[model samples]
Target: MGYTIDPTIIRDRFARSTNEQLIDIAENEIRSLTPEALEFLLDELRKRNIETSQIAELEKKVTRQHNKNVSRAHSALAQDLSKEGMKLAVKMKLENASNSDIQEALQNTGISSEESLRIIGSLGEKAAAMNKTGNKNLRYGVIMLLLGCLRFFIIQSKDDLNETIILLLVLSGILFSIIGLKIKSDAKKISEILEQESLEAQ
Candidate 1:
């Protein structure tokens, strides 16, 4: 089936991604393009960087695999679905079930575990995004608070020789920095997982 390509959407994706990411996307798209277009595309890439050798190797490998393909049909493709089960799956999805929960609920519904997880993962992504955004805010807030407190303490220390107060300020800053870094690290992990999953699905 043919779908419309939105230029704005394409530009936005390019805007949000790096050149290396765009290169990977082009590699996948090359498999579906005509030989003439593929050659032209590779020539353009070569002009950008001397990396067409790797591109040529990848294209040859995937093309050979495509030509020699001999895999069995998927089981899910063979089974028919019941209306009620389909409705239940839809409802479960709409209710924001987790990946594990969806897979369990969709058990014996002619869906493969991989496919079930993929569907649920797409829905789960929204929750992850919200969580990532909140975590990002928390990290930012922590950093700002630490900076503000440090500034305050530095100003206060200039006019006083209170060892206890300086020690407390230093300890508090260390503790807050550690917590903020941990939160930032966790948020980074979530973002990377989502990005990796998205690339794999593509």
Candidate 2:
């Protein structure tokens, strides 16, 4: 059952509504309004000395707008849920979760089974690519750090040590390490968010 508004409240609202506002509702929103609301609105118009014949014609033009409005509302809601499901799915996938686990987690959020599967399917390749990139960055960062350290040590043992080179090497190593670790840290944060959302959903 839909929500029911008090008749008194409805009457008060209509009583206070301007002619423009009232006519706007009758012309554009009459079809979507509750029956009781329409009844109150018509009564208000009658008290305003509006002709019954004009009201009758306005009622006839109720058209298909209400169905269109309902369709758009449902579409918008589905899109929002789909976006939420995709975010959860990506986080779980990054954490190396199974498809079934992601699907279940999505269902727990009120997403339908078909939508959950579609989300999983769409994200599969993208998630794998992200993992690959993150791992690559991490590996490269470690190599850069180690190479810089080795070079620093070798230069230290030499009589003609280049301070400029050593400084550049150390700075580059720190930069790369920070970048790589930042990516990994971001992934870890996403996983933590997924857990939190999952618990909240439950």
Candidate 3:
């Protein structure tokens, strides 16, 4: 069976390809894509290599391409790949981004690779997963969750427990829930901002 080429995969490989490999692609499979599709393909490479000062122009061209004649899937794939280059500078160098974080995050933020970027891309607090901030959140969340459970248990175990202690435990549980919700919200926003930056390498 024939397999569809994943445009981003082609762009990713081509971005890293040697001149000889590019020639091979040109002589073979590259012929299948439309000229506009070809432009979109090359744009992905340019996105990563273009200088900062020139990014805005390229971005305008990219956005325009979105509404062009290429296959919608191809257009989307090209856009996603080009987008990755947008966030490369800030995302890769983030204090918590991995050693592999730089490469993986690039691949990820670039959306060159699939799926896992959600966790590390956002909560990679000050780095990749389990970084100082993420770890702290993980530890703290776990402790708070546990403490909340303990407080509930204490109330259950003692019907006569002081009203003050009961009130304090009630406040602790609510506080834990609020903080947990905030962390979850923050992680999602971070991931989204990072992803958006990739769209223009901002």
Which predicted model would earn the best TM-score? Answer: 2
What's the C-alpha lDDT at position 2 in model 3? 15
Q: In candidate 2, which residue ranges exceed 4 Å CA deviation?
A: 1-11, 17-21, 28-57, 60-63, 125-202
Alpha carbon lDDT of each predicted model: 0.52, 0.71, 0.51
Error of 2 at 81 (Å): 0.7
Error of 1 at 191 (Å): 1.1
Residue-level lDDT of model 3, residues 24-107, one tens digit each, is 443444445554445644565454544554545544444454445355767688677655543453444443344355556556
Q: Rank the candidates by TM-score, best first.
A: 2, 1, 3
Which window of 10 residues has the lowest lDDT sum in candidate 3? 123-132
RMSD of each: 16.6, 12.4, 18.5
Candidate 2 worst ten-residue window by lDDT: 59-68
Candidate 1 global lDDT: 0.52
Count: clashes, candidate 1: 0
Any runs in candidate 3 off by more than 4 Å, and if so which?
1-142, 151-161
**Most accurate candidate by lDDT:** 2
